[model samples]
Target: MEDKTEEKKVISIEDRIPKLKEERKKKANRRLIFYLTIFFILIACVVYLQSPYSNVKEITVTGNDVVPIEEIKELSGIDDETNIWMLQKRIAKKDIEGHPLIESMTIKRSLPQTVKITVTEFNIIGYTEEKGKYYPVLVDGSVLKDYPMSYRGDRPFILNFDEQAYMEMIATQLNELPEHVLRLISEVSWEPTKNNKNKILLYMNDGFIVDATLRDFSDKMKNYPSIIAQLDPKEKGIVHMGVGIYFEKIKKK
Candidate 1:
């Protein structure tokens, strides 16, 4: 007979345990690696910020014709020493647009140190002469009182406009005309007539003269090409555009 008093041996759960200490060690290592990566990234950023690479190496301006590039750059107040990351775009834009001729401006920063400035300038419609010096007139019908140009190019001349109101009115009328028509006009003189109060005379580059008023000058002048086509090319005359359009031949002067 076997000894029945021997206790049956039972297995503990040690084999089923999930190795908690090893898993904990792995997690701690992963957390350390994450923290180290962030620290290195921050250090690199600081180093780069302190280096010369953060400075603006180049600045460019575009869409500028009348305003000199150097002048625009000077007005922008941005240079090689300006930190690209610290550039104030709005401030730069405001500074550049402070120029009377500049209508609008835009600023952009290119990574790794480049800044680009683009500007749109007001159109120079014509010129007004004073004391042998000429000042440019803008499309808005205002003369650059403080700015005098060295020369008058192909732009038409506004002459004999003693009254500021008449000058402004004529400028507005001229602005409405087409570019081709504008080029044909050499000069405009304020010549009021008894029958017409706002009468003006236009001396055309093609050797023809136009007599009209500020009231409907643009409306009637737009058909000038078609009107002149009906006349003899060799004949020089004054085109009267009023209640009726007629041509008065000027006898050989």
Candidate 2:
């Protein structure tokens, strides 16, 4: 006896072609969308980086007294509209420190749109006479060319000295003196003794003359205030420190 069997139907490739093409089309569309999304994100990032929000809009300067704020700003080369992200702080510091007055400097970034510059300047110790102008002498033993109408602060006048080394030595010695002692000095002259080229003559504001050598100026000058305290203030004389510390009163003529 033959049993009844059910037949299975097979789908032809021609009939499945439309479904395969549709699946491939969907995949291509998905890939295209992914590429377009990445491209848009990259473009957005570039635009954000170039916008005004990424630039330095404000600058603050501090720790400066003698140098003008405008001068420091100009030297730093950092101003409004400068890109904060692209600023090289080290380079800017080097540039600002090139000014002879600036002893040292520091640069810092304060968040998204601000920069801060701090500077320390060399102290002006005295003035040197050249031709008819009085050039500023710094504590570092360097002189400035620009001659102001008048010198600021109480500083000693360096007179009759052409030797740079001697001038520098005088500046170094004066720089190390106490503020009180420095104020007592009215003039400094390079008066070399027959025995010593390092000898100097100082005319004190108190009508006393100091005979000292550059080699021992700083060490010996420190005792000036205490030494003067022991002397008769009414007696104007010469204080000698070249050989030994002594005082010689000038006789009234």
In the range 135-230, model 2's lDDT, one tens digit per residue, is 778876777876342555488887766788877888888899998888889898887768788878899998899988887787899999999999
Off by over 4 Å in 1: 1-18, 150-154
Model 1 TM-score? 0.84
Q: In TM-score terms, which candidate is top?
A: 1
Cα shift from native, residue 36, model 2 (Å): 13
Checking candidate 1 for backbone clashes, the offending pairs are none
Residue-level error in angstroms, candidate 2, position 121: 2.9
Summarize candidate 1's per-residue lDDT along 61-170 as a digit string, tens digits.
99997788999999988888888889888888888888888999999888889998999999877888999898888876789988887764567898887787887888
Instruction: Report residue 196 deviation for candidate 1 (angstroms).
Output: 3.0
Error of 2 at 21 (Å): 23
Q: Per-residue lDDT for 240 in model 1?
A: 96
